[model samples]
Target: MTISDILRDSDYSLDLLEKHIDDLTIFQKEQKSGLTPPYTVCKVRKKEIKLTPEEVVRQLYLIKLHKEYGYPYERMQLEFAVHFGREVKRADIVIMDKIQPTVPYIIIEVKKPKLKDGKDQLKSYCNSTGATMAIWTNGKEIVYYHRKDPNYFEPIPNIPSQNQSLKDILTERVSIDDLIKIDILKTQRRSLKNIILDMEDEVLANAGVDVFEEVFKLVFIKLFDELQNTRKLSTHLEFRNYGESDSELKVKIEEIFAKAKKQWGGIFNDDEKIRLTPSHLSVCVSSLQDVKLFNSNLDVIDDAFEYLVNKTSKGEKGQYFTPRYVIDMCVKMLNPQEEETMIDTASGSCGFPIHTVFEVWRKIYKDLGIEESHLFTAEKKHERALEYVREKVFGIDFDDKSVRVSRMLNIIAGDGHTNVLNLNSLDFSRWEETTKDESWQDIYFDGWRRLKKLRSDKNSDKSYEFDIVMANPPFAGDIKESRILHQYELGKNASGKFQTKVGRDILFIERNLEMLKSGGRMAVVLPQGRFNNSSDKYIRDFIATKCRILAVVGLHGNVFKPHTGTKTSVLFVQKWDEKLCPKKDDYPIFFATMQKSSKDNSGDKIYVKNSDGSNRLDSHDHLIVEHDLYNHDGITQDGIAEAFLEFAKKEGLSFASGKCESPFDEAKYKALLDGLEVIEINFSEVLIDKNIRFEAEFYNSKIGLSDNFLYGDDIIDFV
Candidate 1:
């Protein structure tokens, strides 16, 4: 089988396979030689060698470097040895200097998908070979980087052309918007999560401490280092560089981490030190020190955590990171205004809450109409952004790791990590269990004080009143525990007795509703079965009694694919209100179904590409994907959410700020236009929906005044 066939047969991620196939096919087509199985011709070696899985990746990249990147084949070698500390190791592929063929210029490590972490080996090779530039790939994900002096590897967006110098890659900066445009990001990119996973593989797997806790600690220290080295008004982050030896760097890093621990409080022991050996800790510091953490958005961080945790931990619980574009559409359709209190009940990585913070900050940042490059310090934007987060935004998750992650994102979003709590959303009755921590009380006292004002019970926020709520609660398991089931309305029978089991999402529905105030809006993703299953009618009834079902927008089946293909829908509702959601309930409801949710039938994401095969970006520098679910990005010719809003306005839905207009006389209008033919209409929003419609016939004048006679007293002369 060809190299492409091997990757495909491996059953690795389809996205990874597709990317490798594209790169490999182009290289193979350039060769006019033996590419078949028994022996594959090496374009550089100018001879046929046994085709192995590792050889496939090496050969494919060799052609890529030679043909596409303009690296001369004469400078490339099949087996290049470098002297490690005690032994000489051969890298899979190495490129030599143009003038000095014996000196290594670039080193590449190629492996298969199942080989979990190749970064450490690549780092070692680069260090030993004195090759400043190196690449690590597993025929799937690739990381291209250039090592700075003294052990720092800064990521390069891509490998440069032969004529392009390495400095060319370092000078360029990518925005979060442009970063999302790279579909290959999921396939061949380096991230903080990958580094953590690498550490787990190389060090923490045998370390005595919990892997999650240790990774969290390193990340915490890294974040603090980034914070301490902030640029003007905290506009940017500058990473620490070292000229010291590994042991010296270890001591210095531990000192910095200790300072961070004391400042952050509660997450770790006050005297906590780096748990890994000095050499391992030094290696990690060197690997991570140059990465610009704040250059991109939180989605990058979330992708890392989701990837690292999914394999060993969260995947079994059916919790996947919600794609950012999906979260953006929900935020757009919901239209959260500034200062609105919001909460995400099942806040995995806090995407919904954090994006809502982004939405609000965008408005506040632009209200003056000034175009500033960066926002928003905890003290910038009048510190209103931080105030809004502290008082108005909240998130909760039962999982400690998830809660810690959720808190990290919020802390970066604003100085409001305390707003995120680690309580079981479904078991609100025992929320005191989380609140009882005196340290938790110390950090969260102010935010909890604001929350207490909304509670029906002064002591607990079980009946808390939030203006808006959005969540994608976990539903992998059933609530078989009787004590947990006893609290939810969905856990009961018609006779008011508790049932032995209930879906976790079913209970989330009850708890989420209880959290909202009268007239508050909610947009939540639920399994489509909850909307149509015969046995779930009671769940629907429970919702109906508590709120007005304003909209039931059926999400495309592929929306959550490659994660869980169970069809789901975002059910939008408003608690029954005297003005917004009527108790009488005869009003017209907005209905829509997503035509596209970015991913295809096989769950492979199809990002729009340019003629040169790069991701197509937007005016805002965002990588534009096929998100026809909403008109927020204008990726589609027309969107269902956009059309539904127009329909809601025409139907005079109260929540839509709809105006009642004069009824149209269809027969009279048709008769008027019958002879006039085609008409152009323009709706004026400034006026009360009055617009011009004209039918111009070629047989007559454009206006055709004679055919359109109105014999009024003022126009008596007009016949």
Candidate 2:
């Protein structure tokens, strides 16, 4: 049987054991009776063993120890016995000391696949035999630890080779180049989310402190430590633990955190301090030291922050963070230019604005002809891109924790200045009262001043003139307070009398439209009911009056799973203007429905795979999530966004060039043009149509096509 067959229905993976397959396969013996599975000879014990799932991991780890780490067979022992007061248990694998063959130097455990179980067993073995190091793996993720004492176990990047000492591994000088090569996230196939979960099981669950605050502090300090060497490549990183006492390491980390707060202001209070104990801090730092936070995208940090925020009150308000892939699709469909100003009205973690920054940076690099490399995210070479982020991009949110996370991410993208503010977008009347506080002025005054310059009217906060707006506002509850509801036209009934309550997302639809200029465009995520339900026709009517609908892409039901399953679709529109978007009574709208969810039923991401059934990595050495919304930098197939781009060009949209081309014969084209007449049927006139529905599925079903059908120019012709 193949290795994959042997490891099926188990928690083990063959990712780390690929190299040793040929070495072990030569000794495989097939059963003559054909009634039992195959077996293999162990390299260390030189005896035949049944190739069960655990045995496969044990045998492959032995080969890695000998080949990669330079350990010899003479120093390694399998099932070594350990004695406790008249009780004895056998260890999985142990590397004996150099001078004394009976003493264990490094204890490796492969029996338990889960980290917590394996770690607990390793601790017992180390405490009994007085071993200084321990190792744990299940053929997917590997962690090395140094047993500092009976009470503490600190994680190390890697174990020393045969010629090296423990001090050699701890005291090695590391630069950013070293970090890029050895980032644990890539090498061990571990994500930041999994690392945080490990930390919680190790210490944070009972640390008597707020888990979010402590983790945020560590991440803030670690980011600062990496930024110090971004431009200067040879500088040594200061975020590691190098054989120092717990108290000394705490002092050093605290000093670095202080510097981070000074560098990125408004994230924390001036008097704030790390509350994790010295021992707890040491364990946490060692776990995070080997990870590279900056990549071509900040998805590593974004995933971790989403988990932390969701553990608190973020879910109760129906404010799940937007997935990065969705943000990318919106940005690509909009085709935001370098000169355009963008904003996210209900910015949760600022995904739209930050991705906009990346999109603009891609354009700037093309204009300057600067070829991007793997260091694109970490390097600060383009001054124009930084200038655009500082001056043009903006985000606003009411949640304080989310605002801090948004500001921190924006600061990293902009190199210092951030236009992200903590404010309520719907309640514009209270902004003046809130901005008067001296403490608020200290942090938000500069951004507030810049925002006032974009207002269409200086005397009121009701309207602004931004080029683009994108948002996924909260949709769970209703606004019962008449004070907030009175400001929105959607708050009124058919007779123009204000209603007592309205859905929160309904008001944001009006609020987002008001923030755009005459020719500006926007994309907003709304519930499917808003487009199909007969009771919500007034909401659709209000939208059709102000702008020309561009496109509507229906999302899968699993897009926001493990939280809520409200089916949603993105509504794209552009305000009518004399020059950019002339008023049109009859226009064809592009429609599409997504097939691939990009996530499984459990809300975990499903990565693209190669023909050999191995996970696929992009050009940046990151796993690619399988989806159909858009092509991911050429890694995925061209999808709906690409189809819409072609349609926009054919329709002569303002952002796209060229006019519609005909496929008929030259003589037939003349006859068709002569017979055509200009037709004007206002969209509002369709309010009385009994079968009216704005959803893409409702339209696509009428054409006898499935959601997964490939769309191109011919599909637009059919429309």
Candidate 3:
């Protein structure tokens, strides 16, 4: 039997254990009549023991202590005991001091697979035994901490080896290259969400402070600390705790936070201070110091902020941060150009607009022949990308907390300015009231001014001329106000009477359409029932009359789990124009259903794995989620987005290929002017009697109907 067999039922992996496997003795004992053979191992104890899941991890760690860390076997002890008050507890493993062989130098806890549980146990043992350092792992994630005092156990990158001092590890200088290579999120196989959860369990849960505000402050300060040393290759990150007193660390962090507020204005109050207690803040900084929050897409920070914001006001409105994979797919299918302007009306954390900036940056880099390194998204190296973000990207959200998060991300993308507004998008009639508020004007005035320049009419907020619109509006609530209902054509029925109430998403559908200029494209996430329900025919007809349906992609049910289980589909459409869309009544539309869920029912992400069951990393060393939405930068199989691009090219969609000035060759044009015979026929009469369906899945389900089949072609003989 192998170590994998012992860890089959646990969440832990064998990746860290594999290298030390040969140093230990692992064998299967003889099986009885009804019992399976148990894996046995002999290590630090020099005695045979049945290797349970926990024992397997402990044994692997012991080998690592001896071989990798240069710790001698004589210095290590298994099941070392210590007295706590009147009770005696045993630590899983302990490394004794070099000079004082009886003193505990490092205590490793392996019984608990979870970080919170293991960390608590380690803290208790360290306090009781006066151990200077501690280690905790479940074979998957490992953490090293130094016991600064009785109340605080600060996180360290790694424990010092046998010959090195803890000061060497604490004072080591690192660059952006080193940070990218050893990002805790990748090396520890832990997400920002998981780390936050650990911090909550350790301190924030009982810190007597607002969890959201305190954590946001820490993350904001840490991001600023990372940005400071991005260009300087030899500077040490100031976010960490390096033998400083708790009070001193807090002062240093608050100073950095103040600088961050000055650098990225509008997210926090000018007088705001980190409210966490000095000791509490010290532990939080240590927990977050090693994380590299900036990446190729800022997805690490995005995922964490999504959780924090959703816990407060977002869930009540049925809003969840759109998954980055889903955002990438939407951005890919839209094919937004650098010159085009884009906006997300709902704008939860501004996922759509921020990703659109990244997409445009890719194109700009390709044109300029600039090679992107691991710091491509983190560093502000391109002036044109920054200008595109500052000028062309905009977002609006009704939730104040979400708007702050969105604004922060947008500011990071643009380096200073942000166009993410905090006004309600559906209630545009009252936008003037919001604009007049001096407090709102102080932060959002620049963005609001830029947004006003794109309006189709200077005096109205009813229409806009943006080139692209993408949003996932709240679907669980209804707009009961008549004033909001009376503003949209969709709000009124066929009888021209405004409804008393309308689904929030329905109003957003109309609002999104109005935001786009003629020939502009949009992608909106809506309930799947809107596409297939017979009672929603008028809504479908309303869309058909105004724009050509480009595509409909049905998402998996678990895509928004833990917060919601609503089955949703993204509707892609392009407005009619004389040159670009031409009001086509009969056209082929692309249809697809995502096969991979990308997440489990518990809302945890499922990552792509290697052949040996370890998670796969991309060229940037970030874990790739298993999905069929799009081939993530060519890391996974070609998915639905790739197929749609091919179909778009074949159909010569205006966005895919430039609009043709003439429909005929020069010879054909000359012949037509020279009295060549021309045939004219009215084909509407043939199609007028047949029933038509606008739902993409309806056509997708029919047999022998290819992706390129024209509307009404099956019912009429076009030849």
Top model number, TM-score: 2
Single out the weakest 10-residue window by summed lDDT for candidate 2: 710-719
State residue 697's C-alpha deviation in candidate 3, in Å.
Answer: 12
Ranking by lDDT: 2, 3, 1
lDDT of 3 by residue, 141-214 (tens): 88888888887777788889999999998778766667777778877777888888878887898999889888
Clashes of each: 1, 0, 0
**Please, what is the whole-model Cα lDDT of each candidate in the order they appear?**
0.63, 0.82, 0.80
What TM-score does each of the candidates earn?
Answer: 0.71, 0.91, 0.90
Better-scoring candidate (TM-score), 1 or 2: 2
**Which lDDT value does model 2 have at 70?**
96
Candidate 2 lDDT for residue 651: 69
Candidate 1: residue 52 lDDT (0-100) = 60
List of clashing residue pairs for candidate 1: 142-188
